[model samples]
Structures are given as C-alpha cells and as structure tokens.
Target chain A: MANVLVNAPKTAKRGSIVEIKALILHPMETGFRPGPNGRIIPRNIIERFTATWNGTEIFDMEMSPAIAANPFVSFFAVASESGTVGLRWTGDEGFVVEERVAIAVE
Target chain B: MIARHFGIGLAIVFIASYALAQGMADKGGTDKRRSGTQDMGGVLQKMQDDDTANPGMLFVQLGGELWGKASGASGKSCADCHGSVASMKGVAARYPAIPKGADAPVDLEGRIDLCRTANQRAGSLTSESRELLALTAYVAHQSRGFPITPPDDPRLAPFRARGEKLWQARQGQLNLSCAICHDDNAGKKLAGVTIPEAHPTGYPIYRLEWQTLGSLKRRLRNCLAGIRAEPYAYDAPEYVMLDLFLMDRARGMMLESPGVRP
Candidate 1:
C-alpha cells in the first residue's frame, strides 16, 4: 500500500483551471547521512512524478535528493472534459505508485 | 568563571519565579496555558490545519485500514469490537486512564498493546513503530477538538502527585526541570524559539523537527536529553504519570491529536 493522498475537485466548469494536490509517503533518504553504525545511508528518492489527463501527460517533474521526505506536489490542469486525472510516482528500488481521481466537467 | 556564576544566578531566579507561579496556581490565579502550535509560523500552522497536506494523515489512513482488516490468531480487528472509529470520539481526552485491575495508569499505546496480547492474540507493536503510531493517530484523531478531561479516579491521585513532583523538581547537569522552561519561561524565546507551556493535548504529533509523527514519550525523551538528564525506558511508568499530570494540567483545553508542530 503506497498510502498516497490526492485532493482535487470532483466537478469543475469546462475550460476552467482546476487545482490538484498529491502526496506520497516516502523516506526520500539521501545517501549522505550516516546510520547509528556510522555507515552512510543509501540514496533512495522518488525520481519522477507525472500527471496525466485522460491518458495524456499534463505535467511532469524530476525530483532529487534535495526533496524532503513524503514528496508533495500541487499543480493546476484545465478541465476540458469528464475524465480521470492519473498520478504516477517512480522512485528507486523499483518503486512505482499510480493513483487516479475522476473529475466531472460541467 | 563569572559566566558560570551568572548562569547559576539566573537559574536561581528562574526557580524563584517558578515557585511563585506554583503558589499562584494553587491560589487559582495562574496564567492561561497555550499549545505549541501558537508558537509556530503561519506556513507550518496551515500545513497542520489542512488534512490533505498534513503528513500525519498518511498514518491515520493506514490506521483506518488496519481498523477494519482482520489480523492475529484470533482473526479479529479493532472494528470487530469498537464498531467505528467515530465511536472513539472523546476517548483520547480521558487517557492515560487507570485500567481495571491495574495498579497504575496506561497510556493509549500501552492499552493497545494490552489488547493485542489479551484479546487479539497478537504480538505487541514496538515502541514508536509505524503501526503503533498509525493506530494511535487514527484513534486519537476521533477526539480532535474535544476538551482534555483526565479521569478523576481516586487511584490516579498518587501517580498524579508523583508526576507533579517530578515536573517541579530540578534535575540534569544544568539543574533544569520541566517547570523552569515550560512554566516560568513559557511563551518566552529560547534560542529564538518560543517555549510552549508543556501540554500533552496532542499525542502522535507530526513535528517538523522530527519530520515524522512521534509520541509524547518521544518528545519527553528529547526534553530529557536536552536537559542532559537520563531518560527512562520507553515503557517507564514515570512517563505515563508525567503524561497524566500534563493532561490534567491542560484540562478543558481542546485536543489536536496527530497535531503538526514546528
């Protein structure tokens, strides 16, 4: 279970700018910090985040170690039609989480 | 050196004021206590206020899932007996309660562990583990906005007394007690950070300093370490007693469990 959270309006006026909020729970560990045994912690971060509207990419972002734990991104997309907003986060260790939210355009 | 002397003199002044404040509290003229959230910047405050953005909600989500999903040898989940999480409202406000057939108080985590071993036939979750923290946050979230109302059982009186004594007594290499900071200097800045009047209205808090949810015991350990004092084990009775005293002190104050704090 990825424990992802997404907040977006269920209904929006067509051609209107709709705001979307997405968050995922991840440690986003940077390789620099040492553990209690004094060994460096391995770098493991969400590498990319993408949002799609009705299977077409609307926004994309590249993340690095600088991003804090539990990466959160908020963006806007135009409500052109009734469709699903799909969010995908890919990270180290073959980590992939995909979630979808439906919006009915009025 | 002169600096060391001045430090001791300042400590004495703090102690004197603390005693005076205690006297005032006894006489019912003490200053109103405020939550740590009041000391936070607006950005952080908003982060806590919004459930969608609040990181602690992630755990609460897990907790909600665990509540219904059956586990353990008995094949029972929390919902099997407790019904719905909504029924837990106002429950967190009255803990660290004295359980029946128990000599002392057990905080929420302790009670949950007891249930695991006794009723669910499951292993107890480790201290500060995600599952325990998640479950606690989920349960306590139900009590959000309800006033803290420590149970007034007669058996709790002694433990509460001991807790108050510990709260007032000076300890550590710096000879500082919880009172010197949270009592006498509350709302005053230390190293440019405001000292909140230590209240346990929130447990399983999502502290920005920790970058994760932590229990009241964890926060107490941090304070103990800051004062250069030896902290007890995570399951120490002293911690529960201290929790009881703090909650009693903050009686009538609203709970903000899964609270976000900077």
Candidate 2:
C-alpha cells in the first residue's frame, strides 16, 4: 500500500491560503460481498478520520463503509502560525496510519 | 515503414505502462475480504448460504416485513397494492427507468412516490429518512442474485450515456473524477484506510457505525460533500443518473442490501 501523502504549504505567512492534499492506503471494503473462497467476509472498515494543524484539528470525519478504498481528501487552511499539520486514520484494526508535514509561517 | 515502427513502439510502451500501473494499483492491499475479521473463504461461504448472523440477512428480513405493512390514506399495504413481492422481484434491478412520457427514468425513490400517490395515498418519503431506505432495500433485495441491467428503451440510452459521463467526469477542488479513486486507484490506502472498488449492489444498508440504514443517495451526497462539490438533491436527476451508471458498472455483483458495515 502507498503511504499516505500529505501535500500542503511547508511554510506560509499567517492568513495565507494553505492547500492540503491527503491520501491514504486503504481497501475501504463495503463488506457486502464474498471472497473467492465463498465466505461472508466479516466487516473490517475504517470508521473515522481526522486531520489537525498544530494540535488544532481542522478537519474531522465520520466515515461509513460506503466510502471507496484508500480515500483521498483535499482541503484548505488559513495559516495562522507555523507548526506541524498532522493527519490520522482510525479503522477497525486500530489506529492504522498517520502522517505529518511541517508548515512554517513567514 | 519507419513511422509505422515508431507508432507501434509508442503503442507498446503505452500499453505496458498502463498495464504496470494497473497492477500496482490492484495489488493485495485493497482486498476487503482480507481486511475484515472473517477470512476470504468464510465470507464467500456465508454469502452463498443464508446465515442468520449475517447482518445483511437481518436487513433483508426487516425489508420484507416492511413491504407487507400498510400505512396511508388508501389503507393499502405494499403487498395489498402491488401484489406479492415475487411479481416485483428483479424490478428494482432495472431502475431508474425512463417512462414513455417522462424526461428520464424515475429512480427507485421516484417509483416509491408513484406508489405512494397512486396506491398508498401518502406523501413521498423524505429522501434521507430510514423508512424510505428500508423499503428501497427490501424491494431491491428481491433481485438479490440478478445482475444490474438498465432498461434499453431508446429514451433511456441518452440518460445511461449521461450517467457514464458523470462516472468519468472530474470535479471538485481536488480535480478528481469518480474513476480516479474508484477505478485507477482502487485498493490504495488513503489516510490508512483501504479504498474498495466503488460498487452500489448493496445499498440502503445498515451501517454499524451509524447504527441505522441508509440509501445510496445519502452516500453519494456524502462523497460529494467530502470532495467539496455541490451535491444534488437526494432524488435529483443527477443522482438518479449516477446511481444507474454505478449499478450498470456493478453488473453481476449480488444484491446485499441492508448490509452491515463498520
């Protein structure tokens, strides 16, 4: 699986447009069908997702199994200060993945 | 001859690169069967046999019961009005149908409204309500094993084509098309979650997380919101068209409505 990619401003002045693009590696199974061997695949799906900028979460999500696998999300943030933008994904197995990129304000 | 050779070489390279990217995109990481608690074989077997614990079956049962109950001015149950569901089986698999005098094929939601006005004498169910979802799921379940085959009447052709276009059209600030995430990049993890193939065979499903049932339109609305696109109304033609398109793509997948999802 590809690592979650977080593309955003590494540094920016306060109040500037901060672009955020995040993609994770997941198989977001809908859990409706069976596998080749013909078994009712138990539901294992990512339930929640969150993204925070310097500990202040900007985006939060309540995801259902309906979302397609390996979801990609992109949004904007007004840079208020220089800090690390952290992203996290919580799934059935546990906290399945996380990634971070530092943002600097001029 | 030199130009022909160059063209062939270019074509081969394009084909090879496309194949390689597809393989990388399709590697093991995206198998929902593997990710779930149950093993792949177990899931398939459970699907083949009717298992009570199967969350999907529970929803199916609920839908069946709802199909028989009556509540409206006409004082007619769905069974009383439409006759046995057996006659209506496989009917849902062919919706959003374009009627002779209508602009487009009425979607499942629209058909439900038609039933309400003509027989039940009640207002249409709200687009996102549980009652509507349950009924849609129960009705669609009748065609559980059938493949999705949209009606091929001439009036439907353009709408079907439009739906195909929507599936491939890129939108939102992310500049992503449904195909980019669902087709080209399926199975890749985004934010630690695997991206399953986008399929609509099992809808009006019971989501364990929501602890309730929902329809495909609600899910589509959510996706549009996630991507920052302007979402259409629940029963909007655009959504109806998209649903048809997706069902066609998901042809051959078994229906498993009222499915349980995490």
Give the C-alpha miss distance for residue A39 in model 1, angstroms.
2.4
Q: Give the Å error, residue B150, model 2.
A: 1.8
Tens digits of per-residue lDDT, candidate 1, A54-92, equal: 999999999999888888899999999999999999999
Q: How far in Å is the alpha carbon of B70 misplaced in model 2?
A: 2.8
Per-residue CA lDDT of model 1 for B1-262, tens digit only, reads: 9999999999999999987865554344454667777677898788888899999999899899988988789999999988999989998999999777888799998888888778899988998998899999999999987878998799999999999999998999989999999999899989988889888877889887787889999999999999999998887899998998999999977788889888
Tell me the docking grade of candidate 1: medium
Runs with alpha carbons beyond 4 Å of true place in candidate 2: A1-106, B1-51, B56-59
lDDT of 1 at B37: 70
Give lDDT tens digits, candidate 2, residues B40-135: 245544432433333444445555677888878988888986777788788777887875456767788678767877679877788856567657
The C-alpha lDDT values of all candidates are 0.89, 0.69
- The deviation in Å at residue B6 for candidate 2 is 64
Task: Give TM-scores for every candidate, taking all chains together and pairing residue i with residue i.
Answer: 0.89, 0.56
